[model samples]
Structures are given as structure tokens and as C-alpha cells.
Target: MPTKVKPPPAVTFAHPSEAEIARLLDFYGVRWEYEPRQFPLEWAEDGRPTKHFTPDFYLPDFDLYIEITTLKSSLANRKNRKLRRLRELYPDIQIKLLNARDVEALFTKYGRRGEEMNATKAEK
Candidate 1:
């Protein structure tokens, strides 16, 4: 069966949660461009048809690609395959995977609104 692929959203890096990671970048005066919108398939030598992979963040300045996965989706074969393909295609490209707990912890530790907000929401 032929699967359909959706176009990447018109999202920018500014949307990343203003937690420790982001704050740390800011504190260190590091600048990065996120989701520049180049097709992953372009990196493939054979030009075979493959599912498009949209990672969480693309740090152009550092030449790194980040993929953040939750607990459920992290374990999926699809994720593993994508990781493998990325590794095969671009061995030098840095790939980062973050779990949900890390994200929440980031939110709790350095979230602009503070972890108390998260706690209140979780209670509900």
C-alpha cells in the first residue's frame, strides 16, 4: 500500500519550550536555526522512496538534528528504522532523542512558568 506523507508544518525553533535546554542556549549566547525544510531523501544516494522524517529540532549552526520521542512512540520499529536510516545516510549528522520524562523534567527545572504549573496540570 502506498502511504501518504504530509508536508512539514511551517514551524520554527522559537516554539521549543523555554526550558533549561533553550535557556542554556540563550545563556551561552548560542544561536540555531530550526526545521529549515530540506527533504531527508535528498541525502540518499540511491534516491529510493522512503518515509520522510521530521525531527524535533535542527541546529544548523552546530550541524545537529534532534528527535524527541515520547515513551510510547520511542519504542516503535518505525522510530528504530528512521534512526537507522539517518545513521546510514548521514553518519556525521548528530541525532538527539529525548524521552517524555526528560522533557517534563526540563519543564520542571527551568520552565519559564515553573514546575508548579506542571504539577497543578498533572493533578487534574
Candidate 2:
């Protein structure tokens, strides 16, 4: 009998920025889960979840969730509101929101300006 080798899991990232962040985490050997959990922000009268907030990445080692937004400040308001609601509902959870400027700075620090530009273009 021959042994079989399993292929690596395939993950589809919603944005290029998320892929970049995953690469960074892999490079540093930090374990991460992409969009692994969704927290309910709003519920219907019947107890059904009407709105949810799913953070982009979860660093299990650090027990932290990260949400990345490359949108303009004005466009990010909805996400901001969702984050606030998530924080209020789940005060024990640790989550961080990285805005456009923060992500740009990260890309610049990692010499990935081209990828950052691509992400910006995709956002628009």
C-alpha cells in the first residue's frame, strides 16, 4: 500500500490586503486563522442574527482578532460602527481594527508598496 500525501488547505481571501497579512504572519511563524469566526452584532426579534462582524484574521497565539479596512475614512463608518457594537457585546474579546493608513505603513515597512498600491486599486 502506498501512503498518500494531503495537499495544503486552500484559503480564499476577500482582499489582497488579507493575503498580504497572512503572508506576513506565515513569514514570522505566527499561527493565524482567516475569517474564522463571526460575531453577531444585531439580532431580529425572533433571535435570528441580522448582522454580523467577521474580523479578517485571528492570531490564536496572541488571542487577538484583526479587522483590516482599506476604505476611505468616510466609507469605513459602517465597519467602525460594527466594531463598536462587537466591542460592546463582547467586552472580553480582543479585536483590533487596522485602517488604511496603518496598513499602508505596514506595507511600507515590509517593502511591499507595490502590493499596497494593488490593494488600494482593488478597493476603488
Candidate 3:
């Protein structure tokens, strides 16, 4: 029987192929919390429970929350509703969203840049 090999941890978003928006946060030195689960407690006009939404990362340093979406469909309406509700629930909190393409582009560009910088240093 062959032993399975797990891939090494990646420093580049490209390695995981998810575009890794975390790199952007790291680049900006923003402290972040990932996969935070939040339940809705507010009620509708008729006093029905609100919907639950989970944002991707929470930046404590910036006092902002972020969501990264890779779905093909534009979930703008759903995202907006969640943000609005979240604001009403937590007045001081801010939410930021980044789409898949945006994150992927950043990863490709920055990952290449990092590689190039390393090669240059190696040559020197």
C-alpha cells in the first residue's frame, strides 16, 4: 500500500487555487479572524427570527468584517441584506466583500511578484 502524501502549506494563493484573499489581508498587515459563525437574533416586523449569515474573515484591527465569494452567480442582493442586518445588529461594525476574480487576480500578480523578487535576490 502506498502512503498518501499531503501537500505542503502554501505561501502563495495560487498553490491552493482558491485565489487566497488572506494574502491581501496579510499584505496589509490586517489582523483577521476566519470562519466566524454568527446567528441572527433580530426579529422581522411580525417578530419572526432573522436569517443567519457567516462572513469569511473578521479584522479586529480594522474593526471590519469581510466576505469572499467564489460562486458564479452574483449574490449581491443576499450579501447586501446580510450586511444591512448586521449593521442594524452591530451598528459600529463594517463589512467588506471581495469577489472571486478580484482575489484571484491579486494572488496571481502578487505571487508572481514574490517569486520574481526571490529570484532577483538569489541572483545577487
Best by lDDT: 2
Model 2, 9-113: lDDT tens per residue? Answer: 999999887887887676557899999999998899999999999999999999999999977777588889989999999999999999878887887787755
Which 10 consecutive positions of candidate 3 have the poorest summed lDDT?
11-20
Tens digits of per-residue lDDT for model 1 on 1-124? 9999996455434334534354445444566445544437433557765556766666777878766665776465566677788778778778776666777775567553434554555686
- Cα error, residue 65 of model 2, in Å, equals 0.2
Candidate 2: regions farther than 4 A off: 1-7, 112-124
1 against 2, candidate with superior lDDT: 2
Per-residue lDDT of 41 in model 3: 45
Clash tally for model 3: 0
| TM-score of structure candidate 2 | 0.81
lDDT for each residue of candidate 3 in 35-96, tens digit (9 for 90 to 100): 55674747799977777777777778777787776545657667767778787887876787
Which of 1 and 2 is the better model by TM-score? 2
**Pairs in steric clash, model 3:** none
The TM-scores, one per candidate, come to 0.53, 0.81, 0.55
lDDT of each: 0.60, 0.85, 0.64
Off by over 4 Å in 1: 1-30, 37-48, 74-76, 111-124
